[model samples]
Target: MRVFVLDAKKRSLDPCHPARARQLLKSGRAVTYRYYPFTIILKDRLVENSVTHPHRVKIDPGAKVTGLALVRDDISKVVWAAELEHRGEIIHQRMLERASLRRSRRSRKTRYRKPRFDNRRKPEGWLPPSLESRVANIITWVKRLVRWCPVSAISLELVKFDTQKLQNPEISGVEYQQGTLFGYEIREYLLKKWSRRCAYCGREDVPLEVEHIIPKSRGGTDRVSNLTLACHECNQRKGNMTAAEFGYPHIQAQAEQPLKDAAAVNSTRWAIFEQLKRFNLPVEVGTGGITKYNRVRLGLPKTHWIDAACVGESTPKELFVKCSSVLVIKATGHGRRQRCRTDRYGFPAAHAPRRKKYMGFQTGDLVRAVVPKGKCVGVHVGRIAIRCRPSFKLNGFDVHPKYLKILQRSDGYEYEIHSVSSPGLKAGAPDAI
Candidate 1:
């Protein structure tokens, strides 16, 4: 892990090794600052003309999870890695809920107003809230990392313009006759994916409609990956219920679509590229094919951050920390956007916290509570929700402050350091190990 540092005046400096930071802390020369990014504050004066390492930031943007890695110029190792899980789906679901609530309220005993439409025109390069959230999240992390590390160059994966060749090796030239498959061809594809049988009920040679694996009522999209052919009886039986709810255990095997994922990447690829160009650093772009090729060439396992480590011009050949702890920085935007928090009946659900900070801990502050003797005896690490003194709710568990150690201060959003141990590593190894 890269250790961020600050001079005596608190001005940001280039990050150093974790061992150096630990040595500084042990020798009373520096003190720990942030825990998530693992920063340190120096008590000594800033040494003029200190050597700096050339750090490169690699980002593999995805629809749900974005992979980010900071590596030295040589790409021999990843100093820091993160998997940023976006809240795009949650935002879209909340938008649907808001619309439902608004319609319900409007249909009630309320004044009828003419619906406003066409009054506002979408600006150029308009994207849905879900897509916009992902773009903004990538931009947020890029700007934030520049402050902590000496990142001079950026590598971003833009898979929107990839040559989408058919996966079937037999199909080519004349097989590509009428552009792409359709009608009976799509039916055959669905049959091939589902083993030519019903998804929920095993049957053969029956009339089937192009059924949505997840019903439309549940906000499932019209993406072909969500489409499957099911017999008329099975389709009717599976109305509005998920495949799992309809007694299909392994029915979603066909949901993985690189094309659909690439389409999602296309929606915001240029937007993110343009935004990154606005920065002063040099930006380099690559395709998803090269990303996959690099990962396979290096024999790296499939993980968001692992893919990120092998992204772009500097193809990483190896990782020093095989099973490094991943910093999952979920996008929990500043606060609620609604005017007032309300319940389903339109009544005030609850009051917001009066103060941002309670005692010393705030809602998003990362704290570790080690209760020596209680029901919560084990060491629990999570963000603190300080409503009551001495005791506060952590992600969900309740703990007291006496045993709580503040790891990182609240920064509006929540972060988690998942200590994923490498294979064959001893259990006694430290989290950083």
Candidate 2:
């Protein structure tokens, strides 16, 4: 335990004060002792032994210590303590008056262990679907903005781009635009400036060319002001001479397309917000359904579903989503009755298939069967007895239908069901019948 001595009148243990001293009397379990001018706080016993020199002591702010032991060797033991202002009568030098200190010392040891839900089959929490969706929408908007922003303005805009969430892979979902040429490179620039058409001929008849109003070989520098779009044939014919020198009238032009600053182009936050506006969701949700839906819509796959039950009372809540892939949540309500099936749009649904579908198999239909070990195996190609247990008896052998997922007749091993495209005549033609 640690101890500190303080002046009764001046609570501050100033180093220059003669009455201040802080010390460690003992260490282990926890106890205390009094030693004349100063008291020793210890674990088991108090040692009354006196030393030649009082060790200089420093106390943490707000700690209180008392007793004559605070002073030692005819000098003040307190050094480097805050000065306590105001004077009090020193009727007796270093009087050992004291009171009880009741606060307990905190443990310094740390704990390391895995959480309790390590092997839990289901997720602990699920965000409301709406919140998840809105958050997802916001993230997607931001990601798309980064993708379509102008190249020249990208570098500067990236500087002001909110990096607070850039590290979150679920939020950024950004793929940097790629091409070897500089942003100002003519072909791409022209594509941006003129919409990929020849300005002079006003035709998209062929690939366009960047022709100089004043030729570079004739002292014309590479400047947008001296450039115009031309067809390849026209560019070759114009060569290094001004249109005026070639006996053509000069075409005056206004700034039809001004270059976007890299900063303006790169700043994609506004675009992201615009994109997020479409995902109308409640700021709060009932059971995290909204949050989960938004996440699924936005294509964020990694955000863990959170349930409302496990959160702390004081914790602030927020749903998180991404713009990259599906977030599938399996339902545990059914007793594995859920079968794989597709919805109206051909996307996989979370619900399982009905049991009646399994009844579609017929005795004469080509079906794979699994067999138990033995050189002698049952080969029943025709219709056989139908047992109430849902097994078919062929050639005096009984087999369960569940094995159909992995059964192949010739190999004597189990075979999976028919592929979706060719689900056998019975299943394939069910609607027709």
Candidate 3:
């Protein structure tokens, strides 16, 4: 519904309606800038003041993927939507691979000192590589979104499940419950006691619902320790049957404690909130239930981008979505910090790229390329690999330099691509996987 505008020198001024952009283009007062989130640069100065509006960025963060949406307050239409795929698992695997390779080197005749891990200590705000990447990815985009558009405020979904309620949904000890946790209704005691898993199914981090270990239909009382968290499917399947009757007798022998994932999320959530607060913007946090409610109520599929649009306090009643397009981004951190590339046999083959930028563009820069009529026709938008001569790689496809146009530059992280469901807007498409 709205298009972003830049001054003659490409400095962000304010956003205007599509009609104004059209008029400016027709009168030769402006030229098109970016197409994904359409923006234009003015060639003429305007006597009228900048028409600025409060824009909001919402986030729905997950372990694997994160959803983001930018909406103009006046129109409530989505200016941009993205599904950011993370490389946390890849990073973890790479770390493990390095450790294994180092062990093999130690076994061979490679000269080395004793393991020096004892001398190294974790820095402050240290998180496991994967979780740390997740937090940093969210923070990175929060800043990027601000660069392209004037984001007045940010909203995020903080926690998936209330720990206290997960343990004891209804406790009569109001005084005791209200003492610690600063009035947080989540009773993490039960979650911690159960090792954060389903007593019956032993699964975790799947939007767990509170389940009674004993069937209430069979005279079971509402005891805090008797409750457990289970996935929706398991909860419904158990269907009021006691754990014993539900064929989970082995649960008694299994260890009871919060699952690793549950503990990580519980431990890192407040830290993420605190980091966002340092951005100096009015950041709003919401619960997972609130995001789900808004998505279901809006009759939208449960995609990450949709969940992001439904993030916090000022949930839009309607979306001004002109196109159902997604800007899929993958975090490809600032190249690699390592110096050399090695083979699986532990022999050094070559060194990594010494510089981030080549030619005029960086590896993660977004570009549009038009090939000749022989093989690939029409313009294709994707991340580019700046290479030699007239040829370059556009998202793994070979292309020439003359046909490429730079859309956005890499900011030391992430690569963006454009994907659409159908021609002129696809209907009845599946939710983003």
Question: Against the correct fold, how does model 1 do in TM-score?
Answer: 0.74
TM-score of each: 0.74, 0.16, 0.65
| Candidate 1, 1-433: lDDT as tens digits | 5678887776567777677788999999998877776788888847364556678889999988999988777435567889998888778888887776677668785533345796898999999998899999999889988877777899999876432343344556765564434545677777777777776677877766789876766866676677888889989888888776887746755553335455668789999999999888999998888889988876667788878877875674544434447788888865564645778775567767555666787777778888898777888888777774667897677787788889877765567788865422223333342
lDDT of 2 by residue, 84-174 (tens): 1111112111111100011111121222222265574654333223222322332432232222111011100112323223322344333
Report lDDT per candidate. Answer: 0.75, 0.31, 0.71
Q: Which ten residues in a row have the lowest lDDT in candidate 3?
A: 424-433
Off by over 4 Å in 3: 8-27, 32-38, 45-48, 111-114, 160-264, 316-323, 356-358, 367-382, 386-391, 394-407, 412-433
Taking every candidate in turn, the Cα RMSD to the unseen true structure, in Å, is: 6.3, 35.5, 11.4
The candidate 2 region of ten consecutive residues with least summed lDDT is: 60-69
User: Pick by TM-score: which candidate is best?
Assistant: 1
Query: Which structure among the candidates has the greatest lDDT?
Result: 1
Quote the lDDT for 219 in model 3: 42
